[model samples]
Target chain A: MIRIKVRPFFQLKEILKEKELTIELTPDSTVLDAIEELTKRLSPSFKDAVIDKNSGKVRSYYRVLLGGRDLHQLDDLNTKLCDGDIISFFPPVAGGNRAT
Target chain B: MSGWAGRILLVDLSSGKIEVEVLSPDLKLKYLGGRGINSRLLYEGIKAGIDPLGPENLLIFGTGPLSGTLAPASRFTVTAKSPLTGILGDANCGGGFSAELKWAGYDHIVFKGAASKPVYLWIFDDQVEIRDASHLWGKTVPETEIMLKQELGDSEIQFAAIGPAGENQVGLACIIGSNYRGAARTGMGAVMGAKKLKAIAVRGTKGVKVEKPKEFFLLIEELCEKIRNSPIYPRLSVYGTPGLTTLLNERGYCSVRNLQQSGGFEEIDKIDHEALMPFFVKSKSCVGCIIHCGHFFEIKEGPYAGEKGGGIEFGAIGPFGTHCGISYAPAIFKMANLCNQYGVDVLGFSTILGFAMEWYQRGIITLDDLDGIPLEWGNYEAAIKIFYKMVKREGFGGLLGEGAVRAAAKIGRGAENYITHSKGLEWGHADIRAFKGYALNQATATRGADHLRGIPGGELLGIPPEEAQKKFGTAEAALPTSYNKARMVLHYQNLCTLADALEICKFNTEIIGQGIGIEEMGRLLETATGVAMSKETLLEVAERIYNVERAFLVREGIRRKDDAVMGKQGQEAVASGPFKGERLDPDKFNQMLDEYYQLRGWDKKTGIPTRKTLEELGLNDIAAELDNL
Candidate 1:
């Protein structure tokens, strides 16, 4: 088993019961597998925000980064998980900055 | 001049004269509109070393060609010699006032010289009047608007007014419009008040027309739909900017306790968007703004319940709430209302109060210094009392009204140490030390320490490297720690400059990045103005406008040294959190700045636009003026 940490940010943080978590997962588990496991542990909003219910593809605005690099850069959802890995999810967010 | 009225209303308050002059086409084409024209006029009309609060300073309201059109989020630019920063003061506010001003048949309204007594400019269609406003003087923004509306017998008359803060010539006072919206930075209201002008009330029934109505409608519809379908569109409609409180808080980049830590205090939970949900009334929007990000807040079920009003923008939360350790969103909401009503810039007031609280905690200040009112952290009542004192310019407030720089100078017991400012302007919210590109943006910003001048949101936030790479050359620009900021800063500054020149909101372009692209903007221009300009041409205009602003400051004796970095930004590390041990490296920053100056085609030594660069940009006259300097 490999232990990895996950952090949900912004709008998703408000919904997720566990914000930052370190959990043991099966060795060589792909990012998709980890996301699926975490999805079960998270609220419905996370499911709706993270995954396209029909396509199963990450939404355009959604970004999942591992070790300060995007998961898409490594291997999309198939990137192999490693021990002591850090995964961060940035949900869709916006702020009006000096527009007025 | 289908997109423009081709007219400028010049009001000489000293002579009580108003003249309608034709706007030169060459000036409009060369400078663009809105901020571009305003800055050019200020550069040419006002002299160097003039007192910012004196009658010699000119106050201008400039609207872009697209402002009164169906273009989404089009705003107006307000320009004057800033009393706070002692340089070219420019601010943009979004609302219907700008559009109405355009429809009233003018491109710019230039106010020069001080009135012999208190007066207000009244504009209705082609008729403009200087009316006695002695009775309306010394009133809050809302009160002044109400009085003007009642007297005019027109509920639709839009107003831009000042309050006691401006009447006292407080350097941080702002000119408020359509109630909550304000041209808030750099003491524009103080300039207005110094002119003995209480307000400007405009009502226009003439209506404006665009070049291609059908094409314009289609483009606007497409842009509006883009705004509606954006990922955060619904969120904006529901929570507005207050929704961002939780977002910034979670990022470990919250301007917590005035840069003490990432997220201010342990009770920071009480200051998030959820904290304000209980007090939420509804979301508000300006005229023609599809992304309605202004939430109407009311204090309900709290100590201040039943106090209903608007304006608790995201920026206000940092200063009035967490930055000062005040977690009560209700009281903070009320404070925002007070600021809006009193026509004060929340940025300056909050900085002063936060500085005072920090000094108090450090044992450098006490109740004895404040006439028995202790300025402890989270002391909302004490803050409110001080705010009122500032508006009235009473006792200690008299000194504080001079803003953080002057006040810190007067209370010279190492008080300036607490101020994280550059160019005598207070740094709002974001700790630039945590965000490197933002540090460069703030440091090099012509308007002093400000973020909107060039928003590095895409790079600071976690945008995919591929996405960021497409615009900024390399993905390295995406990191908050990377020193590859010149290109990113230049790109966004050009975008922001275009937005300001066209008087469009930056949210669709800078904040979200995908909502409105350069191609769409280019198309919008073609369809509206029949100008047939490309994105590159627009960027050229933006660059020229930037140079003019630089030359204006250069004439005022600003240089590389005056383009000073904020205090402690590059010197010290943050106490803790993700940004811990992260401060700007002096050597890296110097190299980055040198590269930035090279990219801007400015003199690296003095940070001034070179004569060759200015000449290439079709600003021959401005180039000659700077050459003379």
Candidate 2:
């Protein structure tokens, strides 16, 4: 099994009741597999927050990044997860002066 | 024609004269008012080589055509020659001021020449008066507003005022209005000070009349419904911009300790959205904005307990909380209030103060320079003291009041190495090394190092690369790498320009993933003015306005060379945290810049739009003027 750090930020932290989490994933597991496993462990609200009900799409405000790159940028759900990988879940961000 | 008030109020302060001119309908169709019209007016009014604070400089406030209507967060623009960058300067602020100005039966207000004595402009519908403001000159923004309201005896009147920061001609001074809202950048307030003007107050009973009131109301209802149902509405109404705090740190994109490190603030937990939750009392919004992103906070417990204010957004918090190495959320909130009251741009204020603190830590500056103040990190006391001094332009604060660039030069003690600015304007928020597009965005930005003008937030916000590619026609945009990401910047820049021209808040529209887009803009225009505007035409107008702004800067000698960061942003790698070794790639930046220039139909070497490109955009006159340059 490969271990990944699953960190939830902003409002997600309030929902998770934890700032960071250690998720155990089977080898060769894709990001989709990791997400499903991670969400299954959380409350239903957290699960709903990760994925939209009507569209079955990940909500735009919830960002899942592997290492520093968003998982969606790299092979999407098909992207392979590696040991010691950090997957972060970020909430909606809008800034007047912030560049990101 | 229907959306416009069809009048421009001209106040010649030097002559104590007020005249009203008809706004040409053709000009309205082409420019669409707000920043677009303001830039056109500034370009026509001001000549190069004149002092930005001289009597020759023209200060203008242009409201969008849809400003007084039932449009979400419709705002106005303040345009002037910048005392900060000494170039084309404009800033936008939200609240009822723009709509009130619009209801006064004018699309724009132009202030010409310097007043011989302190004065304030008061407008009651079509009637204008230049009243003596000697009694109000040195008051804080809050004080001025209270005094003006009491004098006028009308609490309903909206106002824009400058405080001691502007009175002292601080280069980073901002014009405060709508109580905590401000045209807060590039020292627009200093221009008002230079003109010996103190404030502008207006009260109007006239209503905004559109070409098709029924159709406009239909469009407005539909938009309000869409905004209410949007996925982001709940999060915005709840967390506001504080939502971005932990998210930026999680991505290792947060600027910490003057960007010496990327993320990993020691007290990150103390200032996250959750920490600020206890202080959040209620939701607030501007004019017609339904998102209610503004949160009214009351600090119930802490050193700042009982302190209350509004408009505590990313601009204030990013620099106040993250960059300054401070995590006492209340202090951050309190400091932001002080900035609002003092009439200074929070981003610039916090940055310069942070710069001094970092310099003190690095031994570049010492206790002697700061009059025995330790200047320690996270020391909210010193930061507060400095902010007070900055507004009053006293001693050490006076030296730093000219902004980071001039201050660095004046210090001459290797302090320049610590300062981060482009064209004298301090870079706001992000550590450019961590974000891929920041270097190019900073360099090419007209007002200098501004991120809001063009943002690729969709890439960072988890929009899948394939999805973004399908929408924006760019694969590299979803990633911050220099591989053809310039197109993404251009795309957002154009859309944001559309937002500014239309006076829609970017928070409810573009930056928060999606709300108002080109289609919505076109529909709004058509419904309000009975004009058939396709998405393509709207985008063309946006592009035209952007180029006109660029041309304005070009006239003042801004070229490819001026479009650059201080080099430290790209040259020095991040010292610690998740992005320990990240730095901007020079080669990739140049390649992407070449692509951007080519895409813009600009001369690659000079970065100026070609004559043919100008003519194609229906700007032959601008082309002729640039030819003379």
TM-score of each: 0.93, 0.95
- Candidate closest to the true structure, highest DockQ: 2
Candidate 2 local Cα displacement, residue B333, angstroms: 1.4
Per-candidate TM-score, chain A: 0.79, 0.77
What TM-score does chain B get in every candidate? 0.98, 0.97
> What's the true lDDT of residue B393 in model 2?
84
Least accurate stretch of 10 residues (summed lDDT) in model 2 chain A? A91-100
Error of 1 at B474 (Å): 1.2
Off by over 4 Å in 2: A10-12, A26-30, A43-59, A82-84, A91-100
Clashing pairs in 1: none
Candidate 1 TM-score over all chains jointly: 0.93
